[model samples]
Target: MSPTPQERRAARHQFGTGSDTPAARRGPSGGRKKPITVDAIVDTAFGIVEREGYEALTMRRVANALETGPSSLYAHVVNKEDLDELLIGRLCAEIDLPEPDPACWRQQIVSVCTQLRDQYLRYPGISQAAFAAAPSSVDTLRVGEGLLAILIAGGIEPQPAAWAVDSLSLYVNAYSLEVSLANRRISGSDDNWVVSRGELLRRFAALPETFPHTKRHAAELTAGTVRDRFDFTIGLLIDGLPGARRQP
Candidate 1:
């Protein structure tokens, strides 16, 4: 049986497969399975990513999940790079671009970045794909367009606005990738290598006399939650934009 429209929408959000096309359904040994489509391939790939992280996503793995040979996936997805583009495209599609609000452009851009960060965090290590994927994908361009519009509306010149969009995107991808790596380290069996903030502070405090500043500001160095750091970095980027309107 094919998935209903509601099911497809749910899958798009949950698995980051933004296609409206229905996914293939597996059948019993005697019965025939539904025909596989591009949507089905992406859905299967995302399933693997959700369960085992992006590093586990492979053409053969997706083919196996869809009960087909690796060659079959090539018919729809040309290669791993193509598949990565599709995955990132799906994520970009999920981001809701707010109409340009000149008064709150900075907030709008930050909100979009946060949305993307949350999506990347959902499938750990997936942001790595975003860094590699081509920027030409339609969905990816849509996000760029929206962000550019927001920045321009906020009084930024076209040249700087375009560069700002790139900078913001790079930051989001890098930030999400770092978070995913940290989470993986903490969850892995070798988690003893992952240092706690308090331990870090203690280490800093124990530094040699040459590092007086580090010893004196150990607590400050180890301060703030992940969200706090994310917010602070984004705020710095947005606020540093030339001619950005300061909030009263």
Candidate 2:
């Protein structure tokens, strides 16, 4: 069965994805009002991104959505950077916390990475914040901690495990950012994606004549869907980890 709306809201709060607004905000009529809150501000920011696209998300846009001035938002939100970090934390928290299974660390890593990508993609342009402020958030640190523990349990040294977490998280964040931008440009999945993809391929195939190799195997270069590419990249990292395992 589908979750009740209230249940979903509860989950968001638990995951830091939604705010507990202090009651409904009153319209300009002033009969009743929900005080503008940090959570509400973040929620409004997400709504603006969903409607106008991620690039259009800003404190002013959120203020406009909430029917308040941008300065009012400052009362709840420090600035755009702070808002981005909160967004990142919310996205990261949405991922299922991985269990450190000694025998299945590789699978755990892949599972964690895939879940993270799915959640981060829900908020386009937000994962880019991962590069700047994610480490400071509890959610991001939780993911890193789980992965590091699993790495150590699997016979990997502390230093290598640390680097792996850094490298793996970066890879997922960068890949999601690229895909989010591409999705915006494609304007939803349909003929537009096909046409845009075809155009990209055509450019590559056309250049193969000059570059030789590019023309020879353009199809191979663009063979996979986003999911396929993500899985393959993740597989490479997991499969290669043993080579870097520390000597006892």
Candidate 3:
């Protein structure tokens, strides 16, 4: 069944994609005030993105959510890119990085990366917004700066610490996106959506012999919690950063 408008609204909330504000009126003329804030529009845009994927996100849908016209939305938001930047900024605000600890910089990096992953999962469509942009907003830069400070404090040189911040952000964003997309596909499908690890292995077994490595390690591939996957990727990334120092 297609989701009802209320269901869609709730889904938006679950995804942390947008917020719905009470409508306001101007003067004695209760016809229509400029009925949208940049926050509201972006929040509604996020709702649209969560309901429909990024490719389907549109100003028209966002306006519909806010019960306003697209033209009004354009007054606050320029285009998809502008809206995306706003959404990314909103997502960045959710993360609160702690002080860089020189003694446990590796653990600190892992924690920051985990927080980024959790935030993206909480706000499903955010990765699509943050994908292309470098960290520019205060929150985004603050996270980057903390990561860099931790890495440098752990004895990494300046350039490599900077590079690690960029590299780490890219990995966290990209991997979380991949996981989110896969999850949506699984959850939204009606046919046999809840596959067990063994069932997944059976399905893999049915595939062609060309994917030899996949077949060989099918058990290991599907062998753990999403938390496990997150931790594994984080461990691998953190383990590799020390090597980045050699590149001068």
Cα lDDT tens digits, model 2, 1-248, are 53433443444435643443333344573335457776787788777766766788878788777776776666545578777777776677677866676677777788888888887788786677677454755666677888888787777778877888888898999998898888787776655544555787888876735688777777887787889999998877766775443322
Residue-level error in angstroms, candidate 3, position 89: 0.9
- Shift of residue 91 alpha carbon in model 2, Å: 1.4
Could you tell me which 10 consecutive residues in candidate 2 have the lowest summed lDDT? 17-26
Q: What digit string (tens of lDDT, one per residue) describes model 3 on residues 1-248?
A: 43433443344434543443434433455365555676677677777667666656777777767766666665555576667766776777777777866667777788888888887776565687787776554556667777888888777778777877777888888887877777776778654755778889998888899999888889888898977877887777666765433211
Q: Backbone clashes per model, in order?
A: 0, 6, 1
Highest lDDT: give the candidate number.
Answer: 1
Ranking by TM-score: 1, 2, 3
TM-score of every model?
A: 0.87, 0.78, 0.74
RMSD of each: 6.0, 7.5, 9.3
Give lDDT per model, in order. 0.82, 0.71, 0.70
Evaluate residue 100 in candidate 3 and report its C-alpha lDDT on the 0 to 100 scale.
Answer: 69
Deviation from native of the Cα of residue 186 in model 1, angstroms:
0.9
Candidate 1 lDDT, 50-141, residue by residue in tens:
88999999898998888877765665565787788888888888999999998898899889999999999998889999885547667788
lDDT of 1 at 160: 86
Error of 2 at 182 (Å): 1.1
User: TM-score of the candidate numbered 3?
Assistant: 0.74
